[model samples]
Structures are given as structure tokens and as C-alpha cells.
Target: MARSTYVSEFHFSREVRRLSGESPAALRRRIMLERAAWRLQRGEAVATVAADEGWSSAEVFSRAFRRSFGIPPSRVGAEFRLPAPNGLHFHPPHSLWLDGNTASADIPALMIAHDIADTGYLIGRAAELSNTQWRQPLSPNQVVLDWDGPESSVAAVLCGTVWAKEVWLASIEGRDFPSRAATDPASVDARSLAVHHDDIGAHWSAMVATMTADGRLADTVIDALCDPPESFQLYGIVAHVLTYAAHRRELVRALLSRLDVPTRPGDPLDWMRGN
Candidate 1:
């Protein structure tokens, strides 16, 4: 039974790699190394940290750490202790492991900027559609007046993306969101949508610049989603924004395809590779 389980796990890991373009083992190793670095920074002994990380021996662990981080495990405590302005901390190995020694601070801002630009690209595609094409139903069966109706759906999703980002920016600034009418997809037109897109892009770029300059990506913001509210990290919010924007962009692309409009490749992988 144990042998069967191991085989199943191995196959599952392979499938994950096929889909994500990254092996599960590699991701696990990354998390493990990050945790181990944090432990070492707390003054944990090398051998204990190695054993805790399931390394067969301290020597093996040290060698792996040095290879991954470009430095031996002993030096991690002193060299990689830079704390981001947002209260998040980074170990040197993280930057070395991920970016080959580039400053880690620019990573988040770069990711956010890319996502915003990608969304703008999608919106630009939408703007080129004829009025009839823009208003056409995404599907013959799509319900009239529903949010998914071609014209309304596209507007709502794009507006929601902007609104969500604005919410996070407001949270970061310790201010309430300015009053605006609730997003009405049915009423949104291409001209107004273009204006909203520009506004959001400018706001997002400024926010990224401010956060990067202030080093506040690791800072905590209060999330009122839970009972009595909960503390949410700033980086977590940015991650959520990136994910939501990506999903919405795909939906917009799908809608465009249904409308017989020309679509361009907008995959994140394509963006990462500078396509």
C-alpha cells in the first residue's frame, strides 16, 4: 500500500510540473531553504537546522545551501537580513536563488507593472471593436441584462479590476475609497472605459513607485473580511491583485474571441519571456 501511494504521488508531481512548468520538488526545496534561512537567523545551530530540514548531514546541507545561494549557510544570518519597507524580510539566498544577485526589492514592482500593462493591452483590443461588435452577446445563450452580457461583462470585469486595485491602494494609504457610483456594466461605454483604464494605470504605477521607494511591501494592512477583522500583509494583497487581474484578462480574451474580434497572445509566460 505504501509503495502504491508513493507511485501515485510521483505521477501527480509529474502532472503538476507539466502544467505549471515548474517541478513540485523545486518549489518545495525553495520553501524549505527559505524556512531554514529564517531558522538560522534566529540563532539555530547549523546541524539542528539541517536535520530539521531533512538533510542527511550538515555537510550535505551546507553544500546545497552554498550552491543555491552562492554563499555557505554560516553567512546567511548576517548577509541576508535585509527587511523590506513593508515589514517583510528577505534572506540573501532568496535574491541569489531567484534573480542571480539582482536587488530583490524591484521584483514586486516589476510584476505589478507588467500585469497592469498587460491589462491595458487587453483593453486596447476591446477599444478597437466596432460598436455593434462591442455590444454583441458573448454567447447566443447569454442572458440579457446579466453581467456576462458581452458589453456589460467586459466593462464590469475591467472596472472591477480597477476598483479592486483602488481598494488595495486606499488600504495602503490609510484612506477610505473615494465615492463613485457602483460599476454598472450595462451603462459603461468604450470612451468611459478608456478613461477608467488610464486612471487605473496611472494610479497603479504611482502606487508601485511609492511602495517600492518606501520598502512597504512587507507591511501589514487590516482586512475587515474576517470576524473582528484580520491583519493581511501588503505583499499578499499584491499577489491577490495579480491573480485576479490575470483571470479577468483571460475572461476578456474569451469574450473577444466570441465576438469574432482579433485577439493577441496575452499569457503571463509570454510576458515574462518578453514576447
Candidate 2:
């Protein structure tokens, strides 16, 4: 059937709307226009860009481009670029630029710790949600086996984040996986989750301190998760932890939005750039 119906079936339509303040159709149009603008900036012909983006004609694409970016497609490759509207501005991740000069030895760990703390902050915002909001099913049609409601989804993701870090730490230290937080969302509350977050933060800090003292970031070999257990440098484990933590944080944010809780876009770049 309809695109909206498909999105609603997966329980993501409302979450997408709440996060971006736009319906799916509007968001799709915006993305199409943004891609068209990028193509034009790279000196592609307006007609080609328009057709590739599924616009009816060059004239139609030009009008939408002007409306969205305050300039026609033809002007995009000119000497100066037009400024995007406030909500439309794109921000790249600052953490990607961290390197030998800009970041210290402990920067990777610090960045991951910052994300964990930020996830906790977002979860704390849900403390005031009504009981109905907490208990509401994420999708009206489908039942998630382990997670039945918004709160449990958040709890499960939070638990997953901690477990992921613990797994990495064990690999790095050449030990078995330590005890992890409860994965069942129904068994934990916001207060208990906060304590879990704090404990995870402390464990991360200790691991970073040890790594810093030994200067083994590059030399230590980790038994990474793979078929036959391949060996990888310690830095690989750090990168994996960072990526996994970011993904889980976003899952919790999406669940919160689906519950009708207002959440600002929690991009780590926003936190890093002090926005």
C-alpha cells in the first residue's frame, strides 16, 4: 500500500516525525533536494540532476531548490554558495577530525564516555513521561518479543551499550566477560539505569587510565569478534565500542520520540562542537 502505511506498520513514522519535525513525505522531498544541490555544486547539469532525483522537470526542480536553499540550481556552482535555512544546515561529525595534533592520547575513550553520559541525559528527560506514555506499544501492529514498550526498549538498549563495552574491555584485558547489567527492560527503572550508566562510566575511565599508562593503544593485540577469532590491534576494539555505543544511543532516542516525548537531535557532533 501507501508509503505512510508501510512506515506506520514498522512503528517508525511517528518517531521520524518527532525527531525531524517533518512527515515522511516532506523528509523525503528535503533529502532529494539536498542531494540535487550537492550534484549541482559538483558541476552536474541541472536537467540531469533534476531527472535523477525524480523531479518532473528542470523547472520544477529549480523552483524547489530555490525554495529550500534560497538560490536556484544554476547558482549553486557560482563563486559563493547560498546559506541553508537554520533547520536544514548540515553538521559533520567533529570526532572524525581528531588526530595526532588535535586530540590527546585519551581522546577516543573521552569521546565514547561523553556519548554514554549524553545518552543518560536523554534518558533522564523521560522521567516525567506519564505511565500511559511509558507503557504504550511502539508499533500498534507488531509485538517486539523482549521489549513491549518504550521504557523497556530504552532499558534494553542501555543494557546493550554496557554489555558491549564490557565485552571489549574483557578482550583488551585478556580476561573473561565480567558481569553485565540486566538486559530485561521491564526489570529496571530510570534510577537504576542511571546507576548503571555511572558504573559503566567508571569502568571506562579506569580502562582508559590503564591504556594511557601502558601506551598500548597501538601495540596491544585484541582477539576481535570474527570467524576463527582474528587478531586486531587494540585501537580496533576502541573504534568498535564507539560505533556500537552511538548506535544504541540513537535507538533509545528514537523510542523516546515514538512515546511522544520531545527530544532535541542528539547528534554527538552537536555535543562535541558545543552547539
Candidate 3:
């Protein structure tokens, strides 16, 4: 890295400290430990994470973890984040995020959590059917969002559940609208459904976390692309999403049941208990 930047190693270290308030090695080490903590929180074996993070041994990793977090790795809980001066922290599913703000209070994550997971489950179940079964109109001539056209088939409803978030995320980021070319129910598969769900889920989690941390949900966003140029508060956007995402998820659950796919009731209690 130093050579690529045309600097000596010593000069590189100095510049890094000047810009980030930490040496390069320290930042890397801290980030590694953050990743280890996250993996542990997700139930990875201590020895496994230790090996992957370059710890000399599990004992050594535990010692370092306790030093950094003031708790033994065995008792690791909701927080995996460390005191990162640069606000850099490990984000799941292969990513890092910079979060300088701390929440005064948390926005409950449960509301949308079930919606996303249930949608993914429905998508997987839908994938088990033949194309004919998938495209068969479960609710012939039914409509969800008029702009989204018909979602009368199992495949269409399941795909719509995931696509809703992708489109909203685009709007939030002021990006061009996502293409509707993949709207064919028979063509959409479980893998694509899960990919879109998980990807948008990550972005959604990060956005909610940031807004909750900064208490910025009341902030307004104006849509320049709308012909009439609409405006929305951040919290209102979230509320709107939860409202419709819930609708689509319920549609998926009902449709999946109609096809005799065994699904737990759309109850959060059952979902939380892994029922």
C-alpha cells in the first residue's frame, strides 16, 4: 500500500494516523477483531473465528476479546461493535460501514424483520413448484399495486414481496427506477428472490440503523423524478414500506398455503421461536 502511494512505510503510517487518528496496523487489527465478534455473535465456534482472524490460539483470542470488550467471548451479546475512532465497523454478509452517530434510542427492528424472512420463505416454497403451478392464477385478475400490474400468481406475489423493497430503496437513494423486464412470474426463481431480499435487506437495515442513531427520521426527502415532485419524511417512508410490505407478505403466506406448502402461521411469536 505504501509503495503504491509512493511513500515509505514510515511515511504511510504517519499519514494514516494524521488522517484517521490510528495507524494502519491498528485499524486492520481492530477491524479483524470486530469481524470475529460479529461471527461469534452469530454462533461461530470461538476456535474457528480465532483461526480465521489470525489469532495464535483460542485462548489468545479470548484474552484479546475481553481486553477490548470487557466481557468474555462466551457472553457476547447484541453489541459486536468496538470503539472505532474512524467509525469503521464490520457489517454482515461481507461488508463494512462507517457509523459515527450513536442512537439516543433504538427503532424496533421487529416490524420489518418478519416481513423480509417470511417473504424469502415464500419465495423458496414457490420455487418448488413447476412453472405451470407457479404461474397459475391463484387470485385470477387480482391486483396489489395497480402500477405493478397483476400479482395473481404465486410466483408474482412472491416476487413482488422482494421487488417492493428494491424499488423503494432505489427511490430513497434517488436512483433511476429498477427495470420491470423481469416481471414474468415463470422466469423469477428463488435464488433471484433471496438475492434481492437479502441485498435490499442489508441496505434497509443500515438505513434504519443510521436514522435511529441520529434521530433523523423526521428528515424530508424530495423526489425530483416525480412529475409532480413529491416529498416524504424519512419516518413516513419507513411506515409506508412496512404497511405495504406487510400486505405483500400476507398475500405470499396465503398463496403458499393454498398450494399446500406447510408454513408456520404468520405470527411473530412463532417466527421468533423458530416454529
The regions of model 3 sitting more than 4 angstroms off are 1-107, 181-186
The TM-score leader among the candidates is 3
lDDT string for model 2 (34-100, tens) is 6666667778899998998899999998898888778778888432223322254222211111114
lDDT of 1 by residue, 48-117 (tens): 9999889999999999888777778888854443322222233444443332435654666667777787
The top-ranked prediction according to lDDT is: 3
Better of 2 and 3 by lDDT: 3
TM-score of each: 0.53, 0.50, 0.57
Full-model lDDT, candidate 2:
0.64
How big is the positional error of residue 204 in model 2, measured in Å on the Cα after superposition?
A: 1.0
Local accuracy of candidate 3 as per-residue lDDT tens digits, 1-275? 99999999999999999888889998988888888889998999999999999999999999999999899888888888888778888888589998744542233577767767776677777778777777779898878888888889887876776677777777777788887545446676666666767877778868876876798888888887689999989888888878777787788778777888777677777887983
Sorted by lDDT (best first), the order is: 3, 1, 2
lDDT values of the candidates? Answer: 0.69, 0.64, 0.79
Error of 1 at 169 (Å): 1.6
In candidate 2, position 109 carries an lDDT of: 60
Query: Against the true structure, candidate 1 has what lDDT?
Result: 0.69
